[model samples]
Target: MNINNAYVIAKKEFGFNIKNHWFLLSSVIFCFLNFIIIYFGEIISGDYSQTDIRSLSLSIIHLQMYLIPLFSFILSYDAILSERESGVLDLILSYRVTLLEVMFGKLLGNCIVFTISFLLGFLPVFLYLYFLGIKFLVLFKFVLVSIWLSFIFNSFALYVSNSSKDRTFVILLSIFIWLFFIFVYDIIFTFFVVLFYGSISNYFLNFLLFFNPAEMFRLISIFYFIPNDITDLFGINVSSFNNFYVCLSMFIWVVFVFFSFLFFYFEKK
Candidate 1:
């Protein structure tokens, strides 16, 4: 519970991750791929207008759905399990530090490192687009939302890490979680909508969208940018909730899974 102990642990975790070769490689690939995608996406959209922020934002959102989950899972899937397997957790727990401190510290450290990596990868493209006359204001909001979205997934990975001691199992579970949200959830949602569009209550449909963090993030990010006509066609009813609700949903996901991590950590202790 001591702030100083947590801060110290956070620094250690951050340094460990920053120095890891896998983190470095993943970050490089992330930066290079996102850079190319953003650059070409704008061109393909055929809207070079300086004020056309929606096109650029949509492009970034599409890539982020895949890239952010991959980065978060890789960085955090072994946060606790690896330490336990190597006996490092035992050594660390022998200290004056509480398990809560360790958990908070590790999560905070990884989040900070991920934020730094995200900025390094995306800021250049952000500035480039800004100079091209696209409003930086909207892009700024996108960056913030994207970082929060990454944190949400990172928390989920940490929960998985806390639950499993097997590294192979943890990794496979992480990928499956990613696949379920990013791809499977939508397919299932669409199937339901197609089958029961008229019968399914709007309230129930909204709940389903909010049920998946990935889908929630996508809806929030593009909610402002998408035209009402398009949403109407799909019967999404985006007007049912505002940005605050979307942000709150993400925060809830982080807190919920984080508590799961703490629960497992304590039960083992």
Candidate 2:
């Protein structure tokens, strides 16, 4: 909780990683890939100018749902693991920094880079959609939801980095996190629907959908940009949309994951 110590650690983390050639190169590649996806998504829609912004944005989000989370994972999975493995953790703590300071500092540094890279990668898409008739507010909301998803994933990566000792195990858990959120979660919900078979109401199921950060990003986009009487996501029906709930869900995910990292893994096992 010492702000000065945290700042010192954060500065060091930021300074060291920002110069990493692989990090910079991958960031550039991610941004380029994002642009390519949208550029083609518009052109392939048959007429770039006449394409619906909502549909295009949704498509971008759908595909990005895969890319961004994985990118965030790569950014931080080794944040703590490498330090501990190399005995740098003690060196860091020896400088009058507490474990909380180390954790917060590292998380803050990674998030700064994540935020910048995430926004820059999506910059082309934002401008392209705005010129094609999407309102600023809607695009802003879309950006916010996407950013929240990235933050959630980054926290999970950091949490795994904080808790796990073996680098190989961390990689496996990161892959599992991506798979569970993007794919396995829907399957689980579908199985539940089949098992319940009309016994469970869609409202309850929809409300439960808010629990997953990935789903929340897609749901918020669908709710705000493509509103309808009812929206179905992989057999999970969403009957209502509340701004409070949406914000609360994302807030909870970010807080829960960070605290989980702090409380559950403050000291190495």
Q: Which candidate has the highest TM-score of all?
A: 2
TM-score per prediction, in order, is 0.87, 0.89
Write candidate 2's Cα lDDT for 68-97 as tens digits.
788889988898899999999989888777
**Which pairs in model 2 have colliding backbones?**
none
Candidate 1: deviation at residue 239, Å? 1.9
Global lDDT of each candidate: 0.77, 0.76
lDDT of 1 by residue, 1-269 (tens): 68898899899999998777555676677678877876676577675553355665666677888898888988888888988999998899898777778777888898888888888778777787678665667678777777887888888887788767877889889989999999999899988988997876877888888788777767776764453433662465656667677668877887777677677767867
TM-score of 1: 0.87
Q: C-alpha displacement of 90 in model 2, angstroms?
A: 1.1
Off by over 4 Å in 2: 21-23, 42-44, 265-269
When superposed on Cα atoms, how far off is each prediction in RMSD? 2.8, 2.4
